[model samples]
Structures are given as C-alpha cells and as structure tokens.
Target: MTVSPRNLRALWPLAPCACTALLCLCPALRGRGAEDGAGCGPLLKGSALLLAAGAGPPTLLVRPRSDYVCCHLALAVRLVPALPLGDALYLVPARQALWALDASKPEQRLLAWLRQQAPPDSCHLKCLQILKGLRDLSGRGLEGPLGAQWGRVLSSYALKTALFSVLLRGPWQAWQEQFLVERLEELVLYLRDCLRKRVLMHFFLGNPHVPEAVPVPRFLREAAPLNLLAAFDAATLDAAATQLLAAWSQAPKIIRMYSGPRHLRRSPALCRHVPEASQEAQSD
Candidate 1:
C-alpha cells in the first residue's frame, strides 16, 4: 500500500483522518515520541488505522522518499483493529526509474545485502530463521520484565537491525552452518549492548559504513543520527537491559530449542570459537 507523496496529496482533502484520536488509542504510537521533528517528521502516527478501518484489507501506505525509510518500522504492531482475511499489503512506492537504485528501506537493504554480500549459500537464511525464532520470546514471561514497554523495545525489526549491523561489521566467513549457535549468541549480545546504551541507531541514516554503492538519499546521510530508542527513559532502559541480560545468558539453550539437531550438536564446539560465549560459559 505504499504510494508516492503525491498520492498522499490526494488524501489531503479527506478530513485529516483523525490521526490524533486514533494514535491516542494505540500504545505503540507513544514509544516513538522522540521521533517527532527528528528526521521522519513524526510518523503519520495513525495513518495505518485509517487503512484498517476500511472495508477491505489493512493497507499501510509508506512514502519511502526521505530519511524516514532508514529508521525502524513496527507497522504491524500499530494496527489495532483486525482486518479482512487477506494478505497484508506491504507495497514499496518506488518509481520505475528508481528501481535500479538500492532502496533505503530496511527490508530492501537486507535483501540487497543477502544477494551481494552474504555467503553464497543458505547460511544467511538459517541466520534469519534463528532470529525469527527468537521473536517468540517477545510477549512471554522473560520479556515481561520490561513491563509495558516490551513491544516497543523488542520489536522484530529491532532484532533485524541488530543482525544487519553484525553483518555489516563482518567476520562474514563465520556465517556458516557450524557457527549458527555462536552467531545467534553474537546477535543477542549486540542487542543487549543497544539496550544498555539506549540508542539503536538507524543503520542507514548517517551511517558512513553503509556500502557507497547503496544509494542513500543525501539528506539521510547528512541528517542527525536517528536513535530508534530515543523515547526510552532511564527506567525503561534499565528494565530492558535486565531482560536482555537474562536472554543473553540463556541464548545457547534457547536457541537449541528453536534450532535443529545440527545446530544443537555444533553448540559446544562453536562456543569455543566465539570468545564471549566461551567466557560466559566459564563464568557460569
């Protein structure tokens, strides 16, 4: 349901869609309070509500033209109402001319990275699957330590960003079958660090490390760094860190539960190669 900014102009005549009223009812909107005036110019907070209210399926129209595309997107969490039993529309409003350019959207960036830089095998797919499996912990007792802020802080996209950051830094060769558990451990630790610092930076915005070949808008590169955790307060961050530390400690066992026998068998041997895992095991 993504459309060009011009398409949004068509809706300008429609009574502003009660974005404020709808947003007030959504707890998800409150987490992004810091994003106002921070680059994306405050998400069209409840625009997704408008789409959900329609008779058909839920449609979220994103205009990916500005620095906003580089930040976190937890659109699924924002849709309060259930829609018709059709596929959720996730359209990217790219013009035909811009198709050749690398997209700034996080999903597009991950896709491009997998095609161009990931190991030429199914290892990257396994890595993604492990991350996806970890997401099951979101609303469970473990994550409850973060209180009401769990949904905002540990969204699936946040985990993806952590993985994206790890891949960008390399040791790319370790993204193999043998290191699956260890890599999962690495990603968990990275997320713990982000929570500790209360700043999960948008991977593409103002990131000098992104490959030059990826066509980032000049404004995004020059814009102030976007902190996805900007709205987190001291208390929320403290609780988040505590919850993640517990997860980090249990990462291997938890991953073993979700992963296959191959990953399970490799865990001990793989821990030897990942320094942090080895140290944690010894301390345990």
Candidate 2:
C-alpha cells in the first residue's frame, strides 16, 4: 500500500464524531514543514506565525489563554467503520499565536493537537510504534471499540494518555532500554492502571494533570476522576491485552512480517514511503 500522508484536516464528509483529548508521543515529530519557534521567545510564537504564514498553512496556532498557545488544526480521520472524530489540544509554552473565536462551535481538535505533539519525542515514539506494531500484528485489534458496541472500550486516545502518563512518571530513556517485548508489556500494564482508576488525563506538558485553562468536553469536565475508558469490565479489558500479547507469541514471524518497519519505530504516522525498508535503513 503506497499512500501518501494526507493531512487529517482534509477528509471525506461523514457523520460527526467526538473523541477525547489524550496526549500521546513526543513533540519532535513536527517535520521540516512545521516552523517550531524554540528560540523565538515569548514575544514571537509559532501560532502567531500561522496567520502571516498564509492559507492552507501546515499548522494554525490557537491561543485560548495567555500562558500558552495550542497549535490547532482542523483534523479528522477516516477509520474503517464510520464514526465521528473529535478535536485535539496541545500546549506549547511560547508564542503570540493565532486568534479565532468560534466558541459557538464544539471543541474537537484534541486529537489534532495530540497527533501533532506525538512522534517527535524519540522515547514516546519508540514505545508507540511497537505497540501499534503489536496492534497491527493482532489484525488491527488495538482499537477495541470506538464506543460502537456494548462493553465497548479502548481507543488510540486512551492508550496515548496512558503511554504519556507512563513516560512522564518514569525516566523515558531507561524505559526505552528495555527489550521491545518488555516495553509492550509496560504499556498493557499502564492501560490497566487507567482502567482501574476510570480516568485518563491529558499529558501535554508531560504530566497526567489537565489544567483548568485547557478546554475539554462537558462530559470530560463533569465526569471528573472517571475517564472514557470506564466502560469496560476487568475481565474483558484483561482479555484484550492478553489476547494481543498472545498473538505475538503465537506467530512471531508473521507478526514481524506484517509489523511496520523499524525506521519508523519512533514515528506514529506509520506511513513508509519506500517499497521495502531493510533493518539497516531503520537504524539510520
């Protein structure tokens, strides 16, 4: 499958959907196209650049509050089964940013913000790619249910939050040193903790805390300690994780064959431009 990376902003029209804002991987994922103003200081920000940057700009900066600016985008994903995709939220420490007041509209850019933040960090990217590989290994079993069926639970959003929380709580470098299999187990265990608490907080700043300034859906706010992952029981949840691991042991060769290339181990995008990428290419 040779498919170019389509900006999530452009997608075929479908029924509207809502997904929670869960912080995923690292920020370095923003490639050359993205102009990250690390040295710009407070006076100048990337979001502010979005306006002067021109239309169809790769990213738009949304400054909802004074302290930080969230690089916002109109992002939507086309999944196999049709569903309403939601917004994403990201907190960049510096920048004057862009201005927009569509308060009348619902907030749905959390995923977009997440998609942007993830994959740039080598540590977070390393773990996510392996987990995603496991998911692909399991015949795409990772997305348990996007709230379509009874006892429906699990999605990339929740997993991202859990992964972020795990990486934040511990030293990311050491976490990366563990064998690939061990890292995957840690992810499953981390999700178990989120399932236990029934709460998944956004970790854009590398923490499990969600500041009041960040916008969240009414349910996310009112729900309090409980997260969207509260829908499943222990048995089914355990079964899902166990089954995924089992699949790996059941067929190592086949899973590795279908699994993504090592070069993209730290990239969440998963799209490999080349027809075949050897292990040597992965290390580069």
Best candidate per TM-score, number? 1
CA lDDT, every model vs. true structure: 0.56, 0.40
Q: Summarize candidate 1's per-residue lDDT along 1-284 as a digit string, tens digits.
A: 12355554544443343344334334444545465544222455323333334543245443333354544443543342211111211222233311111222445655685567666653555666666554455346653446567766776667767877887677767776677777777776788788888889876657777677666656456756777788678788767766655544445655666564666765654334334754576688
Candidate 1 residue pairs that clash: 1-91
TM-score of each model, in listed order: 0.56, 0.38
Candidate 1: where are CA atoms >4 Å away? 1-106, 142-145, 248-258, 269-284
Clashes of each: 1, 17
List, residue by residue over 124-215, the lDDT tens digit for candidate 2: 55556555555555554344442232123444545565665665455434444334445555675666555555555543323325434446
The positional error of residue 137 in candidate 2, measured at the CA in angstroms, is 3.1
Error of 2 at 102 (Å): 15
* Predicted model with the maximum lDDT: 1
